[model samples]
Target chain A: MELLKCETSDIENTEKYILKNGEKEIGYGYIKGVEINPIEIFIYENERSNGYGKLLFSKLLEIIKEKEAKLLTFDLPEEQYRMINIVAYSGGRYISIKNGVRRYILPIK
Target chain B: MNNTILKFLERHDFDLSLIKKKCDLGVKSSKDVNPIIAKYYIGKGEEQQRIYVADIVGYDYSYMNLDNSNIIDNMSYFYNENGDGYSTRSLSLLDIPTDEIVYRLMGSFTRDPMYLMEADKGKYVIDSNGLHRLHILKAHYLKELSELEEGDAIGHKILEDKYMVETMARKVDYLKTYSSFLFQQIARYYGCDFDIRPQYDDYGELTGKVTIELRGKNEKLVLNDKQFIKLLKDEIANFLNDNSISKKDKKHFIDFVGQTIEEYDSFKEYIKQNLQEIYNECFSDEVEVG
Candidate 1:
């Protein structure tokens, strides 16, 4: 996936990273804070499963690691099965389930 | 250490741990050494907290503790390994609903209104507890939004997806706003002092005299007037040579400055007085004026 970095000349607060495969925006993703958690992320609908989610997860993890937070917990909505699958496939462990959302915890080390 | 530094650290709740560390570093016995140690400890705490030292001024609140009812789960709360509250600013700017805010102070003391942000941490209160904090947030948000590519999405309140743009075109009136406060904070980070005051007129445009002071004695530290003037002229020349500034503004300022060059009294003073007006007209968030 190609990364669309924010151009300082035409600065944007939009998605920090716009994921694309060739000409199409296969998916777009950005970090959202739940608390100080960098575990919050969004991935758009797409069928291409070429490890982009893993790449995106790793990128987001790098940012969180730079923060004071050591480990990040992913609060994934149950409906987003692809994301859940990606997280699980990438060694994300089920931390807990609460309020209709499943939380996955990962140590960024 | 001066009382100011001691009080600053104490107010922020960093005294105990920081003092402990300073003691470990052989700081206690050293006379007049608290400020140095305090500065070191503050830097360490600032890094450990993952909060930007710059954003220290941008947020204000009182602490409710890790177990406080005010603490919400899954929301990003930042402390300076201490307090002064936390921010998850990417969500939105300050939305404090209550006027009274509760903050945590370590050590024995009754709570009263104090600095929105203490030097070493201490307090976790509402982001809206202080007016200065709110003002900082507003200016910050404006500056953030101003540079973003959201022109088509102007007035849209959505911050995440589209990243809201400047909606106030003609309604872009604000108080005698300027950048001195920000400058001072940045200067402090660099271990210096800066004072800035800029006046504005009834129309929300900058007016009257402006004062800027950067305190230092070293030769390199003192700002040279001629060099600064030359730099300003070059920057403005480059800016006007490029996109967006109205020709009318460029010429009006030029003509006004030129007319009284020989006598160089009233009109020159007027031009000098109105430099900020010209700048605000050219740069402040408003419809481009010719």
Candidate 2:
């Protein structure tokens, strides 16, 4: 699987990467900010339960580490149950819930 | 109906006639009836208490229980057992009490009603919608009550000043993107990094003071001139033509900013002299022709 970096213009310090398995785009993920990276990952419906989500997340972590960010954080809606497990698997800890949006933080060493 | 809920309705002086039983509404679904007066079942079987939602508008009448102490102080953004899932954007409106909502509430009745779910046996209610309107109303009531009770004109004046400060803070926040971009351009021209960090009070409210830092290329802090930068920002905001303020206030503001420009010019001269000294120390001998 190759994670191809995409050019971003509108938002500063935000990076997007598209995941490809033999030229077939399976999913994409992006991380924004430098000191604290607010990351997001997405896998197509047809690509579910095949570990592509984990792969995409791990690849994004590499980019975050390269940027020397202190931690990875994201606000997750309660309905996004599938991503919860993936975040939990990657040692992401629940921080707080505000207005039905749960914040999770994964410390980057 | 449970005895507790019945007494709650009585205490609040709700229009009990408008409340129809779930089945008595004569609708195929609960959605067909007016949601404000519709009966909802809280729990299952015997524990279930038939409940009615109340539409409390600040215009018509005020409920005693929904005053400063109960509804305003006890409003929670957290999720309760009732599962009223309000978005963060909707819930965040409770942060600042603005005059716009108050004017609307006093002018006419609006359909946007705050949905409060009875929690902990009707002690407090979790907030759902129309939080901003409810906050502004309750805060205004609280302010009036305080003025009456204490009879302190100075205290009332302080409240007025605080309100002005809060409004200015909000205006600054509204112009954050443009002001920050402008600051970035200035920073780039000066070969430094500019960052504006907002200051918050004990309650996490914006205090209208921001720390404007100028950092060197090595990320070391060079200057921390927040007051000067804040004045500059206000001057820039005024230049952008924010006519929401009164004409008298605008004239006073322009006069205030006119003095700041002289202060800024002197400040600029100081920086230029300092840079000239640094240039002499570093590159005086290195200059061969140019």
**Top candidate when judged by DockQ against the true structure:** 2
First chain TM-score for all predictions: 0.65, 0.84
**Best of the candidates, TM-score:** 2
Candidate 2 local lDDT, B143-170, one digit each (tens) = 3333333566776564444332101000
What is the per-residue lDDT of model 2 for residues A1-109, given as tens digits with 9 covering 90 to 100?
9999887634577788889999799988877764333667889877765668888988888787787665566566645645754664565544333333544566666
- DockQ of candidate model 1: 0.01
lDDT of 1 by residue, B1-290 (tens): 33432432344333334333322211011012221111111110001121221222322122222222211111224312222223322222223211111111111012211122122222111211222232323233333333345463643343322221111011101111112222332344336664333322332233333334555643222223333334345544554464455566555544433442323242233335434444344334652423
**Worst ten-residue run, lDDT, model 2 chain A?**
A93-102
Q: Model 2: how far is A45 from its true place, Å?
A: 1.6
Clashing pairs in 2: none
CAPRI quality level assigned to candidate 2 from its DockQ score: incorrect
**Candidate 1 CAPRI classification by DockQ:** incorrect
Residue B181 lDDT (model 2): 38
lDDT of 1 by residue, A1-109 (tens): 5666444312233335666678877555565555423443445544343456666766666665677554555666555645665565454543323333555555555
